[model samples]
Target: MAELSADAAWNYVYCQGWNRDLQRFVGLLDSDTACARNEAGEQYSVTLLRGGVPRVVIDIAWSAHYLGVWTLDEALRRDSHVDYRRLRAEQLFPVRERVWRYAEGQRDGDDDVWEQEVSRKANGWMSTSKRPRGRLGGSSRTAGQEDDTDIWREVPVFGDWRWALPDKEAGPVGTAAEHTGEYEAVSAGSPWRPPTPYRNLYLDDLMLEGATVLMEGAQPRVVAHRLRGMVDMPTGQVITCEPRWLDYSEPFTDTIEPGRYEVHDVLLTDPDSESDWWPRAGFLLRVSEAPVVSWEMALRAGEDPRTLSDGDFYGFSGSQGCFVDAEPLRTADHQINADRGREQSYALRKWARMAKRGELHEHPHSQWSDALERGLDDRDGIRLPGTNFNMIAYNCYYPDGSYPTWIGRATDGAIVCFLTDMRTTHPVIATDH
Candidate 1:
């Protein structure tokens, strides 16, 4: 096992989570604690500490989401090597004014249209705190320490900020080919499998040929128009493909481009509902060479509700005088629903930040570029220069909730986020590696 030096010890703790009671970031202190070897004879240990004091020890070698101890160190070394001061600092938006404007603006520009709304707090019309939670940068100070630069001076993180991809598709539906995979045939337990409509039809029956162009008219025609799956986006259409074949007998020369066409149709397969299941159901397939990366994060309030300022509110807000100031937040009545609205707000903020920093690996397609252009002012939605964390704060109307998502590297050197508001903030470690 590799011995931990001062820098190595710092890397381990810097990627872990922050300890609220300790009043400082937490991480592993020494290298000897990580000497325990797994069945593979690999040394692995993840110890979280508060001010060089051990708090929680996780044996990541044999635990879930294990990527080996060496990987953890490599990621940490890469993240810590960068001089954050040298990188261009991101500009921060005026969050308080934006949320206030949204709250004050009526549905139809009239006062009584939606009058029950109000701002949560009037404090700090602009939360200009250089650091998160009014605390100094990570690795700056410890619990009892006085000097800001006494603990450490560098911003410890894991490699350049990159988007981690999901392990599997978000949807549950699978195709016939997936059912016939080697694992599916030998698996012991049976899952509640949804029937694939095209399971009966095998690939041989479809007789799909590779790139067989049938005609070359104004709109080039193809032998088979592949109908994958459908995706629903905010502005227009988002589509997903599952290898289903659809026959495009009619001439789509007018609507489609010159390239190969992938035609899709809106289908309703819900048996439970007597009414039409395809109410406003739509199908759109937009294929682009431009790359796309997707990931998910659980968002939550990190600081005490009382300490949060007006700028903390991100997306939507209530009116200034009409709504209860702190009742919603204090009573936990304003928690953002992760599945419904939080994801949309997160994607908005994340992509905007990535684009502005020029860290986005894949060049966005025209559609995505257009969407980003529309929200350009949000380039620094919940982030500031020199701060170790990136945040995504927004509000939803129907559910009447506010979401302040915190994203940052922990002392342990993992890219993680704090989703929910507990007495202590726990890092939801990202496992894309």
Candidate 2:
């Protein structure tokens, strides 16, 4: 037998039959040697070599169960072909026959049969559906199944040294006092709070000067377009998305009182610069003027904000721009489609007029000119010439991407605003020094 290293021996003796152990064993073998591996990188079979000759073959079934050692010929016989019917006969058929027998005994009529069928189907569906996989430590039972103690008994390492294992205990894994200066203690009964302070920025403070626009048949002159609108949210549930892509949006679960909410577009214009494009900074949907005391991610119905992991956030998709409105607007699917068609037709007609005037020169500097030509007046909302909609729409900082929306709350717990951060420019926080 080849001498094993300390790590190799410890793993072979103490962690035998584990996927990692199998992988380590295969890694040490010659690369030309054949080995069977599952999709999960779990090695199931490998031939042991002595002087580059096959000595014995080790094999493990699914999940590393039923590990067996065999001679070269025996391993060859086992690998030659599969006997699926024999497997089903030995494993599945007996359990299924027992279940059928039990059902037949309980059967009273077609109704009983129907109930059994329904129950079986429901169980099958539930078993196959995606669910969060959690580990149960020690000798705990899972989902009414047998205690894991019995399952661990089959493991080679556990079989011989089960009594040496320490008893499970319940307590905090570590204490703040143990690392006094490294940790901060929070109140036990208080509501959960964010780790960092959220910035309370004023929309008016974000204004810039000397922004210029080049109108058709006119000189490039300085112009400032501040787009602001009030959106009615009768359903309380707020939704933001590209107005035309309302179908792709979901409502925020943290709803406010049903009422009209003010939506303001944050534009960044530099008077000193020569760029014609007055890029948008972001959009703010104000719910109250009260100073915001807390901020949370605006999650949808199915999402649990409390369970959000790092890098997880609720993002609104924007193509041309974004809209802020109530969830009730989503019910008018047909009207939305009609309005979209009308907007497309209007854009086509405007383009034709621009072409007729021989003013079709490519304006590669900015999409603002294209939006202006399409009759999207920078007034209350970016409403096309003819289409009517309740949502407040405005161009985002960049043309398209996913943007995160945050919900701010006042000291008294009332919602203050919903901020869609486009990440182009940072607004001056009122409380910042």
Candidate 3:
């Protein structure tokens, strides 16, 4: 075994159980009475005891990016007094007024309708709540943000921000074909196993053969569609979007070269119910010709990807299909609003045409209405007037959920592409070397 550094030894003692080497290391501090004990719970605690009394405690919680140290008194007080429910309630109290204003406008004085609308909106907000977990604390202080309170001083972990030991040997990294056998074997008995006649789509295949044109009523277990326009990455910063939405989308902190890239939409054709449409499985934005050899989560500025919990993602909000584009979608507010107005007008015109042609009633009970709301013309892609940016939208899996984007890199660490994982099909094996 290699000799551990002081920080490594300390982390080993707190994260793993104490061994002879760790015990000897701890002896240097105070051999007589100093000892450490691990107490695992929803939050793992490592208590440092002196004369059988807890003096210091180290805590590591699920999804927490750092290890926290607290005095025994501080830990006891927090554990006994902090009420997450009360905190959550306080946090959401201010949202009621805003929700009411919007709901009231839509309700038109119907108390039941108003209440129901409020409840629905409130519940939706609660479901996607980004409240901090594990401990009661303020956010880290930034230029315009409040400073974090000194409840528990945080310490960064040594290796990966995941706070776990690094893998001894790196996993294999290659194209989809090289890993398909392993993926099939692992997914054979899993819930996410692909159905019979399933086909896995790839960027190379799509670019070479063009999108698989679907006939009306034709359903393939898996399919891919080429987004009709090129994405402009003028500043290299990228953001995802649901083309139909007029809202501004936030960009990921990381960037690629300032250039244009091709976009592709991947989807699962079979829906959970007959009324629903095919939902998004993932997206591919080819950034370079280099083959991807590894992947990492695409996070916003100052956000650490390793701290994200399972099922958690860092992507744009979606109600319809989503696309990728460069930041500063429009240069001026007037231009942005004008583009939005045009989309709205286009949608209204299309709906009117469909209604006049008797096409609206064809899928009356189906979720195809959602697609109509996005405008039929935007099904392939949409380029804003007087702008180089283009949006390639597609239906989201079931219409809504937070999807995560992964940065695919070449063996030499150059970015090859970006993938927005909607189905959670990819394996977690990428390592930082």
Best by lDDT: 2
Q: For model 2, how does the per-residue alpha-carbon lDDT over 42-137 read when each residue is reduced to its tens digit? A: 334433322222223344333322333333221122111110111111231000100111133332222222111101111121111111221111
User: What's the TM-score of each model vs. the native?
Assistant: 0.19, 0.40, 0.46
Across residues 123-210, which tens digit of lDDT does each residue of candidate 3 receive? 2232111112212333222122222232222233322222221233122211111111111112111111101111122322322323
RMSD of each: 25.8, 21.2, 17.6
Off by over 4 Å in 2: 1-227, 269-277, 305-312, 338-389, 426-433
Worst lDDT 10-window in candidate 2: 92-101
Where model 3 places Cα greater than 4 Å from the true spot, the runs are 1-45, 49-57, 60-65, 69-145, 149-229, 244-247, 267-279, 306-311, 336-380, 386-388, 424-433
The best-first sequence of candidates by lDDT reads: 2, 3, 1
- What's the number of clashes in each of the models? 25, 1, 1
Q: On residues 174-227, what C-alpha lDDT tens digit does candidate 1 reach at each position?
A: 110111111112222211111111111111111222322212132222223224
As a whole number from 0 to 100, the lDDT of residue 200 in candidate 3 is 24
Residue 48, model 3: lDDT of 38
